[model samples]
Target: MPVTHTYNEEHYCKSKRERRNHRMKVGFIGTGSMGGLLIDAFLSSGGLLAGDVIASNRSPQKLARLAQLHPGITLAESNGETASRSDILFLCVKPMEFKTLTDEIAHCLRSEQIVVSITSPVQIYHLESVLPSKIAKIIPSITHSVYSGTSLCVLGSRLEADDRTQLLKLMSHIGTPVEIYEHHTRISSDFSSCGPAFLSYFIERWIEAAVEATGIDHTLAGKLAGEMLLGTGKLLTEGEFTPQQLQDRVAVPGGITAEALNHLRCSLDGVFERLIATTHKKYDEDVAKLDSLFGRDGITRRK
Candidate 1:
């Protein structure tokens, strides 16, 4: 079915030449947290100008919020308009919305236009079946907001060498893009994407303990823990110190650090075992659901 669209002509990039003239036209179908962060990072990368970007969201409140932040950006009137007007379209909606959103706007996409899915459940084959375009899938982290975060990219069948090169060139400014097979995208995503939040939560608990143990304020304790983590990260990246060597450098035998480390370390074997098993099992189940959604029968419900 042909999708109906409404757009302000001044905001839409209509032609191939226009999309390619200086910077590529970038369209965002959803302007929620992840979408907004990515738009910020991409603009910071200098690969795109504010005028080259187009955005649309179902929620008026989100549109209002995004407008306050990016006053010069073009807000499309509808999803179909956003899909039809850009060289690269980023679908940043939630996982549950992917199938329905794609089904709605896929017909509006041009064959040469590239559709990139940031949501995990939206697989490449599903996109290929729905849209007449090249597809790229990425799992984004909140860290990308910092412009130094790592992201994983698993390309669809249609994206060629030049497409990959252009995409990587634009993506590299935001973070390191490690290309991997589609199957690996999920677990690697779990690590690089979820690691920051998970580790932050872990750090928060330690910070609370530090505050209680020393009577320091939570803010000061947090700063202390954060600075140590920053330095530790630098050390680990700068040198080839093995985990044992790093531990030894800090915790002497019979010392307070070692005493605590020994206790935590003993518990970690089972803790981490459960963490691994649970994470993998959940991701595997999600992938299986995606398979069912995109299976030959096309019988699956999106949500």
Candidate 2:
């Protein structure tokens, strides 16, 4: 089945040569939800022609659907074919599949090809040791799909300047990409990658309370809570106020807001503190385990 697409012809034509000059032939191994999102962001960013991107997955059916949706993409039969066809490859597989997949495609990857892994805890050195290509590790959040998330990318010391620039440009469309040390990547994941989930938990609690107090429909309550959070996020970005400053601004002296804030601080401190500490501890433990199993070098595990 042919996929239908509408694009700016003039824009594509003018940019075609420029894109060909600088754009990479990209391949994605694993067309799952996250992989699909990456492809979407890349295409939407333009410059790279549709034919420049290829993808391969374990399930041909999944690839077929993706190819149908994006007619410009070539579907590879195997992981090695995907790696060989592209200048840059993204390993979007699960942590358990990392070693096996890398082993399968190692021989196909060229020394100049750049491989970016989104798998948690699997460090860049593990990838470099297994594959001959230059490697990078990125801790990306689910918000990448929305094109407004944060990604903490740790570039391996072995990567060339051109490859690093290409990576930053490719990922910039999805969100703000921050470069950090390898060890800091794991810590960033604890806050930035998993931060969305933590925020969602609080929003869920807020919605539940709103539903109970106002007798609003559960769905409406959820929407309201989400919008509130969205607005708060925008305010935080636009205003120069720190989090503490924002909190102080909301709590008026001798008022309901102040009373509520006091109650929250007094009653919720122990519970929230314990939850945050436990989450960080668990994240560190997972990183330690990956380092033990994979052997760390450029990719330092957080312990």
Candidate 3:
């Protein structure tokens, strides 16, 4: 049966009048996995009109597929065209493609344009040097597609207050947008960008171990692990407990939880600490390489 809303005449009229309209010209240079996800979220948010969004990619086939999927989105012939047409241009290409792509579209960029770089390791300063335009850097998680993610946005030195506000408003629809210093973008990338993969890896290992120990079906183990993780996340968010506090609550004195934790810690030998340390080191190294290629000291000067 089809559902229908029963509304009073006055309330229905007021509701119709209160409907908001938003139209922005947004363009994306890369329509890969993350880029496609962003586009999906933007459209789902209702502020952006289909006709106002455009995208361009190196592969014609990819562009064609996107255009077909999103009939409202325009397909730009090249990066230059995308930059020229968009009020807010998302440089979604890989870090390796940054220099070449920015150089190609730099001349086409306007002073009024809002350029956002989603590539990691390439700092805002490097993007500014290459494009010489108003820019911002954003580190967004995959969860952004579901409007439940977290994002860290760093404004460029040249960005105006209004431009920053607009950017924040747009991104807030997709996730929680925190205004952060550009120097901390690397740290944000560690938690907000790369965190999902790290969490997934740990969950996969736990599920495998559970299967091995209990001889349970692998699918059931996987489902249980996923649900438990989701519930744990909700507990952390809704309950006012620090991670250590939560662990203490679970690890009752002389309980099985405590025993298991003790055994795991001893067997792992500071595994979590090593994982974080190694990840940060690799990120720093990648940032150093990017700085070297772009001729900058680094995103943050470590004392």
Candidate 4:
């Protein structure tokens, strides 16, 4: 079944029909995982037409794949060309490559153009330093491939009201856009961006345990787990029941579910605390390296 758009999303698309018909161009400087996912989401959602996108990537094969997937999208030969041509540009390259990629296209960027970075470490401060255009950082999630999940957005000071509105509106078509501060980037990304893999790992282990312990078919266990996860996400997002409330409803006192919960509580105590601490530590190290590379005192001075 195809996903239906919200009323607001439908209205937004209808309002932008003239712009789409006139061929408003959205450029992507890299056609990697997140970038490619975004392109597909936007097109599939009717937020942007295939002909309205112009993309370029370091690898020719990626561009070729995108061209095959979306026939009308123009593939630029270089990052600078894509930057120069787009009304709104997405920099989807790695965090380390931000400086080089921005420098490559800085000369061609226009004052009115919207420049967005998809990575978390390369803050808007870094982008604003070189980009002449409006800048922002939007941390996307893997779950957005299914048009679900939250996207963390940190708008730069230079971004105008109109630009911010447009950006958020576009993002809304793919996922709920949550405006956040730069300081919250890492923790928010841990929840929204890195969360899918982390949650999936636990679910995978759960499936494995069920197969190993009960002699259930691995395939059947995986299928059941996946459907349960999907339904659980829906229940949480629907806002009728809090996690604890849901658990209370499902796990009667001394029930199997309650026993399982107790086992999980004992086994997983301090696990997430360490997980978050470890990720934050790595984040700080990455920020320090980026600081050294970009010659900023630190995030403090940049802010």
Task: Please report the candidate that would top lDDT against the real structure.
Answer: 4
Q: Pairs clashing in candidate 1?
A: none
List, residue by residue over 85-169, the lDDT tens digit for candidate 4.
7878999998888888876788777666789999988877777766788898999998888889998999988888988898999
Q: Go through the candidates in order and give each one's C-alpha lDDT.
A: 0.79, 0.76, 0.78, 0.84
What lDDT tens digits, residue by residue, belong to model 1 across residues 241-290? 77788999989888999998978888676876677677778776876776
| Model 3 per-residue lDDT tens digits across residues 90-114 | 9888887787887687777766678
Weakest lDDT window of 10 consecutive positions for candidate 3: 1-10
Off-target runs (Cα >4 Å) in candidate 2 are 1-22, 270-273, 280-303
State the lDDT at 53 in candidate 4.
Answer: 96
Between prediction 3 and prediction 4, which has the larger lDDT?
Answer: 4
| Better TM-score candidate (2, 4) | 4
Off by over 4 Å in 4: 1-23, 297-303
Residue pairs with backbone overlap in model 2: none
Instruction: Give per-model TM-scores.
Output: 0.87, 0.84, 0.86, 0.90
* Residue pairs with clashing backbones, model 3: none
Q: What does each candidate score in C-alpha RMSD?
A: 3.7, 7.5, 10.6, 8.1
**Top candidate when judged by TM-score against the true structure:** 4
- How high is the lDDT of residue 22 in model 4? 55
Candidate 1 has an lDDT of 0.79
